[model samples]
Target chain A: MNFDLVAQLAISGLVIGSLYALLGVSFGLVYQTSKIFHLAGAIPFAAAGYAAVWAAKSLQLSIWLSIFIGLAAAVIIGVLILVLGYFPLIKKKATLLSLFLISLGLSVAFPNLLQIVFGVDNLPLEVYDAEGNPAVPFANPTYASGFLTITKLNIVQVVSSWLLVIAVLYTIKKTALGRSITALRTNPAMASAVGINNKVVYLVVFSVSSFLMGVAGILITLQFVANPTMGLQWTLIGFIAVFFGGITSLGGSALGGLILGLLSSLSGIWLGSQYAPIVTFAILFLTLLIRPQGLFGKEAI
Target chain B: MKTTNLILNASNINGGYGKHQVLRDVNINVGAGEIVGICGHNGAGKTTLLKSIFGIQPLTSGEVVFKDKDVTGFNTSKVTALGMSFTPSDRPLFRDLTIVENLQLGAHIVKDRSLIADRIAEVMEIFPILAERRNLLAGRLSGGQQRQLSLGMALMVQPSVMLLDEPSLGISPAVVEKTFEIIKDLAARKGMSVLLVEQNVRAMVKITDRVYVLRNGEIVLEESGDDSRKRTDWWQLF
Candidate 1:
């Protein structure tokens, strides 16, 4: 592979990896606390991207404002799931499998509902100039001592993704909320007995996770066109990242995302791009077979 | 004795886990400044009775009164808000939290931050070891220290009645003795009412003012500590 191509691919990989990490963190948070596999979490990512695009186009809102609206919508969706979808089952002490199925049903329903509203066409977010015209940057080539360089968007994605990962890590490590989350993960019954309202904690966690997922959706949309079906691919990548990292460890998930990103990128370059998914799935299957707990998972009680 | 009124009353209580009736029509009462010991075999309803009072386990059919107010069917937090605290036998301390954080959680119902701090200070005065290890993670503490922390957490709420389930379980003999001593001090000095459930009949009788022997979800024997000790034939129930 050429040096220019390698740099470009690596940067793209990092951006995708960062988005994956954010998604993994969201999935990990819910799984760690409630031990419920929230299949509906994927919906927020697709919904937010589409919502942002539609709002920006139809309402003539600023892109940033549209993003915020999308995030708010994601939070509402999260609360709906927590209250309407999960609460009743939880109140009844429903089995984990049943909760998983319910989440799956919501996951399927959310995207299909979006398709019905927005149609199945891929929606491109309009990046405009002062003249209200598409401002597609011309491809600038660099040939310096037998090497080429890519555009600035790749650089921005690389920097922003890493920054977000660091910020998330710092927040979870240093905050009171983080401590409470850790305590709940370790022993929820004890945490509740000590007066930490489990319900409140779960709600906060769900909202935060959904917000992060929504943010990831925006970032991913910036990188590629948004579609009603994009959430499933992102969700699959997120699940792999979460499992690779050790489902319970936030740090592990971030690391897993980076590793998976690098692997997928390298495989796409070396092998056929079609083999990338196969390679990723093979790695995941092997990880599961060899170490079912993932890289940083705690030993089973 | 201060002659304080009864703090907890349970009449005709029946409960069990999953169709197995562990506590059957059991009647028990604990007054302020009283330490009531509940002793029973492994399968007996001692822990079940405590669970029923704490609202952790649903009562099959019974009435639980706290401070002469009917608190039956109240959830755990509501029951806790009503001046009753439970320390489960499993030592349900928030293992990932520091000792101070765990204590803070105990006073979670207290909305005023100042009052919560004051309660923490008061609990520290009672358990100096906890105060010393305030910054350490609860799981890092020795079993004895955890037991003390659990008891301290229960005390943080300043509950009228403290329900302690097997405070001595899994602790060293030395720590077990110290735990019982603290139980005694709470009853004697603080005038705290305690319902202590334990399988260790000998240790429980040493600190409790009154003793109840539970068998097959029923209280078959009730006596003063001295009377129960002198008549040791109850040991056969186990």
Candidate 2:
């Protein structure tokens, strides 16, 4: 057996899986509370990546500062969409289909607009050291045991993802805000009667989801490179993870994401890297066929 | 009814779901510490009336005066913040949440955590079944127990007035009787006014101070609870 090849595939899968898990959790957070679908979350994902690159290169800031600027930009964009796009239609009691279409339109339009402004090239955000040197991502310390090797970035992704997932779960499961969100999710009309502000919860969900998206975007950019169209595929996968995991449970989404990541990686090893996307659809189709409610969903979608 | 001690007065409410026009200039009022009942057949605008008064449904024409202030078309949250809670007939409790979680959300307007805990304990004292299964998801409870939890949740806010769409929905007759009894005791003990809508006229009139018999989207008979109980031809209205 090819131990080195297997190890490489497994490590890569975990890194991507952690990213997918973060995105899935983010999508689930908003979708569960607001029931908005929020397909346009792609705009924030790719935009943040591009924004970080621009900030690092043009603004000449440290890598951490650029990422901060990028996240801030993503949050502002998200809030603007809520104010300009969603609130009016929600006031009029528009259907979910209408909201989906509005979001899809923006998702498609904004990323393409980014292409026009930033050009079609893939922008690689450079991390700088204190002496103004492009930091070597490879300089991350590595740990190896048996056939498996791990780097600082890999550990960071996995550890941080779990930490974030745990923190979010704790907040939603144990905190008052989380309880209110659950109430809003379950019965919105009754939530209002009980004095839970739907608009406030909606804003909170969007902001948190947007922040998660920004973090995922920058993380992926650090590993690979940022492009306007990078978000389209990620958005599709995020939805798949939500359904595959279960729409109602945040923990389920993270689990689904990791499972999807592993499956894709294994498929790449068995078949070719080109066949990885096929594995995603097949699993989703199977999950829908067997358990449309998803792994952790209380009710079928 | 006398205008002077009224806590809530919804006058001439005319509205519906986008031109359906379910409620037509209907007036309903609940006096302080009085348990007023709106008894009607299904689809007689009973739910719509409650929705309008609770600010769940927007009224095209009407004035909702609570505590002597005209709150015409305030949304549900604002109405809730101003001390009014409505319990719908269908799935009154958040089924996915635990019993205590549902009760905790009941006091969403209350900012103080300790105060909310006290309210939960107070409500649980009235409905011991909720205390028994406080950690269990509300959906897992039996139909009767779920209904009890729903009313217990409304009590968490300690509101001045509560609007309950129906009392006996999705519960057994035995449970319904118990629920009505609890309602009577709760009203007297808490000193909170209640605006209840129910299909069971006998059960409603028995516990209520006043009863409004609604038919075909209008109140056809308004009588004191004792008068309503004494009436021989009560079934003739339906």
Candidate 3:
């Protein structure tokens, strides 16, 4: 009923929505190419955060260097997961179900491994001076409008996420690689007939998807300290966003994330935040019941 | 005896999805600059023969010679890289991509980007309508235009041989007529060999230099295009 509250909720929703969109793109890209429900996406999502934290706290690096190392780790681990875990199965012509299970197992096991090594506590990488308060590169700088307050970090997160997603969409729209990805998504058999190497595409798709996931992990960690198991939650949200957006379409995923974010934010405002999960589930249920194809998706979710 | 003329010569190829063998010792060949047709009813292994040659469908036992090199067990992308292009019957072009983009994808095997552009230009010139609609998505085109784009995409590779499975699969009869003409023109003008699989035997036999009639899972009949055209009772071959 209150307009100011509504606007505030909307701003936060848009921010969260942008983050979800980035994550959704990450999840959707690999699925589109390989049709593997890459649950192990959670591995890089957590790994990148942990890597950044470790690089900062242990290796004594700058925030930028740490973030870079984290992203690099994400790409390598992402491809390594596919190569060691999925590629052999892929080569064997194992079914999507098999790949999904393998990814799911890795997803489950990796977080626990993180907990084992990193402990059950949150891994907040805070640099410090002699006083030991905190030495953060960029603090939560705010940008306020009439009765509406926003942070510089929020701006960075939203802008970077949307820009990256847009760049991917542009590449998909204008570039040769994008066309090949579409070709593979449409008819892989025809893709191979046209001389698009399946192995190479698979590697590229995994690496790109992983890089996006890694970036999400690092940025989120910087905002709110990384934990051992934070990835599982994001992966769950990311996967939900993918299906909600129409699994095949990148734009659909973004729109899906926005809608999901808006609904959750609205629920949090009016229904006391406790009902956010309920709202998301209700949307999921309704989508499954009514338009499983999603807003812009061409196929059934 | 003279294998040099054969751009693709796949012999004793036995394969299928699994358990059920669709292609049984299927021996087929496409001579240099020849248009070869394999005609059969649906599920009669016509498509399977093409798949085996392209190496998309792994053979239980076979010898595939492309440009007289043993390319058996090579992946489809490898086969494509070795101057062979295949336009499958179903959704050959990436419907979401523009005609030019589809053509660019068709020439994926070509390492040189400039050569790819030139090939795209050549393809567009061959199919002028595709040029007009180069920016348009292949999915938006009429069924005929989609077929043209699909063939043009394959032709962009400037392949020594192309394996086309039912270029007229889901188009109008008029489109089918035009498609066959284009295939004939491409083969003659480009000196490209084609091994085409079609359920539309009448149209296919007309343009093809030789016709191999497949039945069950084997080649039931082989005849010259001239002889095939003369025979009104071609159905008896199956």
Q: Candidate 3 at B210: error in angstroms?
A: 2.3
Q: Could you give candidate 2's per-residue lDDT for residues A1-301 as a string of tens digits?
A: 6868787888878887888888899899988988998988887888788889988888888777888999998888887788789999999989999999999899888878988999889888886666777763433788878777787768877887777878888889999899988888889877877877788988888988888888888777777789888877787798898899988788999988888898899777678999989999999999999999889876777
**Which regions of candidate 3 are displaced past 4 Å?**
A1-8, A128-134, A140-149, B1-4, B111-114
TM-scores of the models, in the given order? 0.87, 0.94, 0.90
lDDT of 3 by residue, A1-301 (tens): 8888899999988888888889999999998888889989998988999998998888777788898989999999999999999989977889999999999899889988998998999878665555555665565567788889888778887898898899888877777788788888888877888878888888998999999999889878877888877888877787788788899799899778877887788776669877777787788888878888876788884
True contacts kept of each: 0.31, 0.75, 0.79
Residue pairs clashing in model 2 are none
lDDT of 1 by residue, A1-301 (tens): 5766776667657767777777878888888888889888988788788878877777767767777888887788887889899999988889999999999998878778878898888887654556677432221232233354545555555566667667767876776677667767877666656556678889998998888778787777765778877877787788898898788688888788878888787766678778878888987998888887778766421
Scoring each candidate complex against the real one, what DockQ results?
A: 0.42, 0.70, 0.67
Model 2 / residue B107 / CA error / Å: 1.3
Docking class of 3: medium
Q: What C-alpha lDDT values do all the predictions have?
A: 0.79, 0.85, 0.85
Model 3 lDDT vs. the true structure?
0.85
**Per-residue alpha-carbon lDDT of model 3 for B68-173, expressed as tens digits?**
7999999877888788988899888888777777888888878798888888888878889988988997889999989988888888877899899999888999
DockQ of 1: 0.42
True-structure Cα RMSD, model 1:
3.7
List candidate 1 stretches off by more than 4 Å: A127-171, B1-4, B16-22, B68-70, B110-136, B236-238
